[model samples]
Target: MRFTSHTTSADGITERDFVHDGVPGVLWTPGHDPAGLVLSAHGGGRHKRAPGILARAHRCAAAGLAVVALDAPGHGDRVRTAEDERFAIEIRSRMAAGQDAGALVAEYNALQASRAIPEWRSVLDALPALGDRVGFWGVSMGSALGIPLVAAEPRVRAAVFGLIGATGPLVRAAAAITVPVRFLLQCDDRLVARDAGLALFDAFAAPRKSLHANPGGHGDVPEHELAGAVTFLAG
Candidate 1:
């Protein structure tokens, strides 16, 4: 990883911007020794530094956990391909028309995960001393990619995934994961059916997994849940 810029906040957190094999990313570290490392994946249509990701990074850093977020394929600084553009348009049109876009989303997520999973593994390889306590945090599109990553990468010991349903290849991937998992489900999420989310949670192979379901839409995750996630990953 090549660091492009470095800055420290008043709160004693150091932020570094880096690029690894053309993938742009940000890493946040506390001034003191970190509790562990957490890899954060942003939601659909959001980049590595999306507001939610930034907030989580800061919170995790403050809790003595180093955090890193990278732009997925066709997101952030990466150039979007024609296929990416077409998928975006189609999904939006389907949603606007009140049509189910699950199939389209599933296919697109598979493609993105094919590219993203390797990129995340490469990022882990490039970083020094991640140890065995690495954790993953992602929802929605993040879960689309993250489930497969945590399944394939042995380095990731725990994960928090949600805002997505059990679909396509994700179910099989979820079955492959054995790490402790914390899954969040928005009870009234319009994008993902509640039954599908519950099915996904049930598919996890982890012996120790918990589901936290709240009454809200996709983006209405309660602030208290966010605080709880910080505590979970900081352990």
Candidate 2:
């Protein structure tokens, strides 16, 4: 995963408001010229502007990577258009109706995932025209979402998973990925504790994988650890 750098200005914080499963998002490149693209996912209860993920996007793009900070189905601009106030409520409501919460979220995710991956991938597909390689970067819930993309997609040469070490869905993804991976978490993270995330990291089937811990809450991956993520994606 050799990522290059280039300068970029956010094309726009456009909402996929009109497109089916379209996610409103920011599209930007960090440095002078980018070497790759990072599909960014935010943490639980948060949207794509999450500080930690954005910080890494700075470094990645500075290193020449295009960044697409994703707005999960019920997040960002999408949250505004959601029939409900938030995705959690929507999930809870569906579950209350005897709908499988996980299945519903997965269905919602599946519908939106393809739209997103290709949005970022389209940037990557066009990257050769710009001269770069492409990959993904995600945190907390976003990292959880990245599991499927990393597992089944061959285009993903590298992945950065942080702020989240595990999830209910991740239990099944334990050995699904075969790509090089770098995982990070907070030691006393109330949101994602060291133990649980570590357990998930242990489940990775990648021949090459690494993990690091810092002191922080669930909201973001700390500044000190940002280098580690960039290093991982850069690796």
Candidate 3:
């Protein structure tokens, strides 16, 4: 990774911005020695700097865990193509029609993973080793990409994911993830059906997995719930 710049947060966290093979990312480290490393991913249409993702990074750093977040394919500083724009348009149109865009969404997500998952692996390879234990934190689109990542990368010791339903081959991927999981679900998620999300959670092969469900729409996750995720990752 190419180190560009770094600044210290008022809270004593050092935030470093860098690039890896053209993908932009940020890494956060606490003032003292870190417990481990956590890789974070942002939702669709959002870059590595999304507030929720940064907030989670800060929380994790506060607990002495190093955090890394990368801009996914077609997001942040990555170059976009006409095909990418077309795909975005299609997603918007499909959602507006109130159609079950799961198939289309799944296809796009899988394609994104073709680049994103490898990018993550490369980041893991390129970044300076922070610790032996690694965790993953992702939500919505982030979760969509992360499930497969957690399943494939054994270095990822645990995960906090959910918000999108089972899509494409993720069902099979979910079955392979044996790490402990903290899966979040929203009862009235406007974008993802509750049953579909539950189905994905049920597919997890991990013997230790917990589903934390709350009543509200897609982005209505309570702050306490996030704290719970931080506790799980920190532990």
Which model scores highest in TM-score? 1
Scored against the true structure, residue 146 in model 3 reaches a CA lDDT of 94
- Rank the candidate models, highest lDDT first: 1, 3, 2
lDDT of 2 at 45: 56
The pairs that clash in candidate 3 are: none
RMSD of each: 0.9, 6.7, 1.1
Task: Give every collision pair in model 1.
Answer: none
Better of 2 and 3 by TM-score: 3
Clashes of each: 0, 21, 0
Q: How many residue-pair clashes does candidate 1 contain?
A: 0
lDDT of 2 by residue, 1-235 (tens): 1223333347422212122234355556543555666667775556666666566666776665667665665566664445434556877787678765555455444544454555555434443543444567776666666776677567777888766545555756648877888887777765455777888898889898888776756654566577766766665
* Residue 67 lDDT in candidate 3: 95
Error of 1 at 183 (Å): 0.4
Off by over 4 Å in 3: none
Q: How high a TM-score does candidate 2 get?
A: 0.70
lDDT of candidates 1 onward, in order: 0.92, 0.62, 0.89
Q: Which 10-residue window of candidate 2 scores lowest in summed lDDT?
A: 12-21
- lDDT per residue (tens digit) for residues 179-204 in model 1: 89999999889989999999999999
